[model samples]
Target chain A: MDEDAKAVATALARESAADGLRRLTDLLLRVADDDPGLAAIAQELDRITEELDQITEELDQITEELDRITEELGASDDGRRPVGVDPVAGRANACAPPLEVWCLPDGTAGASGSLGITYQGPRGLVHGGVSALILDHVLNVALSEQGPAAAGGELSVRYHRPLPLYRNFLATGRLSRGADGELRAVGEITVAGVVAVSAARIVGGRGVRM
Target chain B: MDEDAKAVATALARESAADGLRRLTDLLLRVADDDPGLAAIAQELDRITEELDQITEELDQITEELDRITEELGASDDGRRPVGVDPVAGRANACAPPLEVWCLPDGTAGASGSLGITYQGPRGLVHGGVSALILDHVLNVALSEQGPAAAGGELSVRYHRPLPLYRNFLATGRLSRGADGELRAVGEITVAGVVAVSAARIVGGRGVRM
Candidate 1:
């Protein structure tokens, strides 16, 4: 296969692995009732610990093998994308909650996804930072499609309500063109028809590094 | 052992597992220069993918075992911290980057940590949302130490420069008391003596839910 095809396949495999890990993370956060006697719980815990240890050992071996491969490859840092396959926001990123976006005729964008316990914070609510991350990404997507890529200069977010986990959420971003060639955007995250979080930001003009 | 001790041990084990996964994630993002012959690279990638598949299968089994245990225990959802062991900020959480916090006598809080490729965004820079996450957590910690738990209401962040990944960074939060019983705080994230991000937020009072 060509280099590009190989790269794509590697990314896909990595993303799948990430998805598996994400699912495991969600399971880890789930709380079990105190109904089970301490002894029974302890036994289960012990079993789980043993399994985790085995997994860790396997991972260690993989890391060593990867290190050896790196040396054999005589790898040198290249300017080709500082973050080769970011674990977040990359279409193939496993760490990010799956988000699907649709562009509107007027140049705005809409995104929808469900965040699970892996993204939970503050009781049953989604982490405030996670909300910001999704909103920021969507806003940038809207801007990138319109004109030159820009970096976020300032972002202000208001939490109107808690964004719940394990439920579908919608996010939208709209770009406003400025006369002086500056770009600004506003984004909102809504859950069940309620606007949970709202963000507004100004983007520096072209040549700005994010 | 006792129930409390059992809980602690379980948390520790989960954290260790998370840590292992975190390391694997970092390794996944590190790109080897295109020095290795494509055949060699493909062979290694295939091996890694196979290992990942095995690990994922093990995780699936673990999850099933956990589910069975939960059912046998007659677990019911309780107010007992939905996320029994947070993989993000919990001391026992292995997924989170190591963060150390020191509380000052003057009511401010200081935090230090290094972000890795797992949190990379925007061309090797730390994710903007991650900066907000750590800052928000520190601010809440400062507030909680002073009084009751509060929730983030509004947050404003200005990105003066990109936050670099895989480097030591400093974060600090200071509280501003409001005579009317409101809580407000300001925080900053700095790298190499340069301020990269500054944030300020108003937190809801006693009854606030984040």
Candidate 2:
């Protein structure tokens, strides 16, 4: 248990799988950032990799069984993972920081979180691609309710400034139909109430739904 | 040593730091992709995180010592890590697959490699943000030689097809000067000799130089 978990005892002791994945990612990123020694770190990582392999094998067996049951029951969602398991924005994925976006009453999707060292580029700044990743996911989430599924067509991003890392960020998106009747997701990520990155995405196959 | 390393004796006995990082990432991704049982996996990861923390602490001490020595000797490149350490394309970064770009005599930059499961977005496709991440780095590598440093201004990426995972990818970039004398980087990523994603960037501060 971590300090917070120790202090709280109950609520934080048994960390949720999503929060655990995020915590694991931060630990890995700590390794990626200062990114110390070469072969030596490799040796340690090699050892851990072995352990992860075992865990993966065990998980694979269970997942296969679960998937088989789901298929047999015909309870699949077109083979698409729910937003809770989304690779980028999903709370469960260890790939990047978890992104939580919600469609507001004003018809816009809004998301906010502080990124850590795992998503860095340009020395203490958020990688531009990361910005794109968040915006794209935010947009998809914004319009998911309006359509059955959303596939990205074209994405354009303009970097207004360098978005710093480990800082609070606010992202918002809204759905719009273009002149050709194509749905579009316009999104942006901001720090300190200032928009630093903006994006417009062309969506297809209906928007992504949770 | 693995079977291959034992067979090769000397050559494969030791893995490079970058290769080791990539290997570690793949193992982690296997867990991320299969994404099997959540809570159990987290427990294992939690244990490994403790080990990694110890390694990080040791490495940090050595890294600080080396940095101090480098500074005392005035052996710094303005704190810029070589392309080898780039967070996205650098072999050392476990964030994404390593991208190696080279300048061709034909006045263009060419790069190629197969991305792994860690970069997946759609079910079996590369994340669009990852495509942007790679293309963005590829272009910067292409134009880096033209100037001292490169900073991205505006980046636009168009996805022609859904790029698959664990497949060979070829990326190319070139240096172009806009009409207003602004330097730009244009690049594309292809799989099976077919262009799947293309990008153009407005670069500043001259261009990123190796």
Candidate fnat values, all: 0.37, 0.17
Calculate the i-RMS of every candidate, to one decimal place: 4.4, 9.2
Cand. 1 Cα-lDDT: 0.68
TM-score of each: 0.84, 0.63
| Candidate 1 RMSD to the correct structure | 4.6
lDDT of 1 by residue, B82-108 (tens): 333442465434345567766787778
Q: Residue A33 lDDT in model 2?
A: 16
Tell me chain A's TM-score in each of the predictions. 0.79, 0.63
lDDT of 2 at A148: 61
Scanning candidate 2 chain B in windows of ten residues, the lowest lDDT window is: B6-15
lDDT of model 1 at position B14: 67
DockQ values, each candidate: 0.40, 0.16
Q: After superposition, how far is residue B207 of candidate 1 from its true place, in Å?
A: 19
Scored against the native two-chain complex, candidate 1 gets a DockQ of 0.40
